[model samples]
Target: MVSRRAFLRGLFGSFLAALAMLIGLPLSYKWRKRMSPTRHSMPETRSGAIPLPYPRIRGEMSLEEAIAYRRSIRDYLDEPITLEELAQVLWAAQGVTETRYGFRAAPSAGATYPLEVYVVVAPRGVVLPSHDFLEPGSYRYVPQSHSLLIVRQGDLQEPLYRAALEQEWVLNAPVNIVIAAVYERTTRRYGERGIRYVHMEVGHVGQNIYLQATALGLATVAVGAFVDEEVQRIIGAGPHVHPLYIMPLAKPLEPYRVSKEELIGYIESHRKERR
Candidate 1:
């Protein structure tokens, strides 16, 4: 028979182990549930919303390669980009990265995500593998569902081109990505400082688009000189959503490739000219 004191000590140890199990199991389950990736089924096409193809996580070009090759290409071939390429580019701009927290590809101030992305596709601008083209119109990117909501039913390229100060690239490029922002989203939370934050976020998004386009062997030029009201109206955006950047994207007519040494020499030559 065990001593009474020893028996009580063993009983206390058992009680402690039981208490730990009771507390730990529920916590572990909750953590596992949180950590697991949630799957979202493709939503039914309704309300003029078209689901975009799932974006690929991996690409042929490395991040470094993409950065090195990135150029502000203005001239493009008279050809259309594929639907998949358009999807990838849009995903890079503002696609949701984390489902649990509703995080996006680019960082945002307090996760305000004030920016909205719209694509103005020219007639036969984006082609599918089957040679079918995405209907030419302005479509709003909805990140949560990874889909495009049709804003307008016909080509707004001429109006958009005119609004973008009649830039040839704007008229020629097969697709124009219009980045707009609703100030209230960020401003309401961060006060006046949020305006700066929104600008910073747009820059981040622009860089993402540039790099992604580079990776896809495409070309784009960010056009900032535009009548804000005109672009807003052309893209069918509400008054609250102000236009920020218009990036015209397409296949470059001639790829602008330059090595580091070539760039350095060019800079030096420019400096000499100034001197």
Candidate 2:
């Protein structure tokens, strides 16, 4: 029943199948290994997600002190801010304060949070305790995980500065925090009125950032003048996400200190001149 031609043909088919497996198996293994997620991967591994240190609830500065010292600072020294400081500021902006209900630090209208926070880091902008620096890039803050997801790699300071109407502070500061809104998150529930709520929520978040920065002896100024479309592109935001604010943060070149009385006196002087 087995002819010599038939046996030769069967042997040839088996050899080809073996050769194919030898070629394909290694490639398949390599792909799977590359695609697999390592949950405990370190930042140096470039896994694209960086876990932030836990935020401290009790800072040295009291709430009143932070409020009193809060001022819009424009000039900054060339220096890198610590990752811990960055973490606290991000937490203040929108980190989840309650796990069970997923409530954020900033109050959302009807618990429908529409705000997204992003940070654009300059070269040598943020440093770890070991003195290693975070790669200069745009990172989107994930509130639930208290982590940063890399959006784009490489220095974006110049582009962001140009986008912000060539503000020197944007270029000079070590980091810039950009706040964007996804209106649908709120608008779906409250309709057009939700737009107003979203604005209010952003204001709250901005104030939180200001206070937190002040408490940490950091300086920041809320920058509103910029081309919206350019900023959205620089942050790699989706079409639905619209930028609302850009805050440049760094150590002040000189600390500005003023008492309430001094502020009142200056105001009075200006009022007298106007009259």
Candidate 3:
């Protein structure tokens, strides 16, 4: 039995969700698909260390070439990564497509963007893959052009590693992307039902990162073990930007691991109907 007031509230919530979706979905899609009218602007922050803006090189490798390079390296070589490689990886993860319709590296729910990317760049300055270790610090990703924005600069590895349930990989990876989810972006439209859509969108972004890393001859693995609040606090997202997944990436050895049978199984499951 439902009270009149509760019934009306439910009806109102549904109506509001439908109306918002009707209008917001297209706008969100256009927003994701379009590029910023202005050139890339790194968000202003006085963090002392200036984040280097690397020119992103696109279409450098064929899909097969990238697939061949896919791997997850816990141990990197004795050499640091080049700026160009970093830029390329970030761009592939979420770079703007055509300066219109903000089509980013990953898909979204109704174009109502809900994900924010951040980097935990090792070393306060540039992290060298070589012997001279760089300092440990946290950074936010500027998606407009995939630039790194320094957030908390210090030896956060211990805390971060602990937050991630003592996963040694957290301390070892050269760079980690903390993928945060802002639920309301979609919930405002689809209401509670939007929860499912938001989760799907996050997976899309994570896969985008994996594929891009694989393409760039880098190693990466998806992580979801860290304390959500701790990650959010470190990355400096509001209550809305809830952390969902963390992906740490590094350079790997040649020859990626692939399971053709597993891939086929996945393709078949969704071929008829996702349900």
Q: Which regions of candidate 2 deviate over 4 angstroms? A: 1-47, 260-275
lDDT of 1 by residue, 165-205 (tens): 89999999999999999888778767999999999999999
Regions of model 1 farther than 4 Å from truth: 1-44, 260-275
In terms of lDDT, which candidate is strongest? 2
Comparing 1 and 3 on lDDT, the stronger one: 1
lDDT per residue for candidate 3 within 80-142, as digits (tens), equals 455455666666666766454455667655566667777776652244334333344566566
Sort by lDDT, top down from the best: 2, 1, 3
- Candidate 3 residues lying further than 4 Å off, grouped into runs, are 1-60, 68-73, 124-136, 253-275
Q: Residue 161 in candidate 2 has what lDDT?
A: 98
Q: What are the clash counts of all predictions, listed in order? A: 0, 0, 23
- Candidate 1, RMSD to the unseen true structure: 15.3
Candidate 2 structure, TM-score to reference: 0.80
- Whole-model alpha-carbon lDDT for candidate 3: 0.63
TM-scores of the candidates are 0.79, 0.80, 0.67
lDDT, model 3, position 205: 79
For model 2, residues 190-221, the per-residue Cα lDDT tens digits are 79999999999999999999999999999999
Model 3 earns a TM-score of 0.67
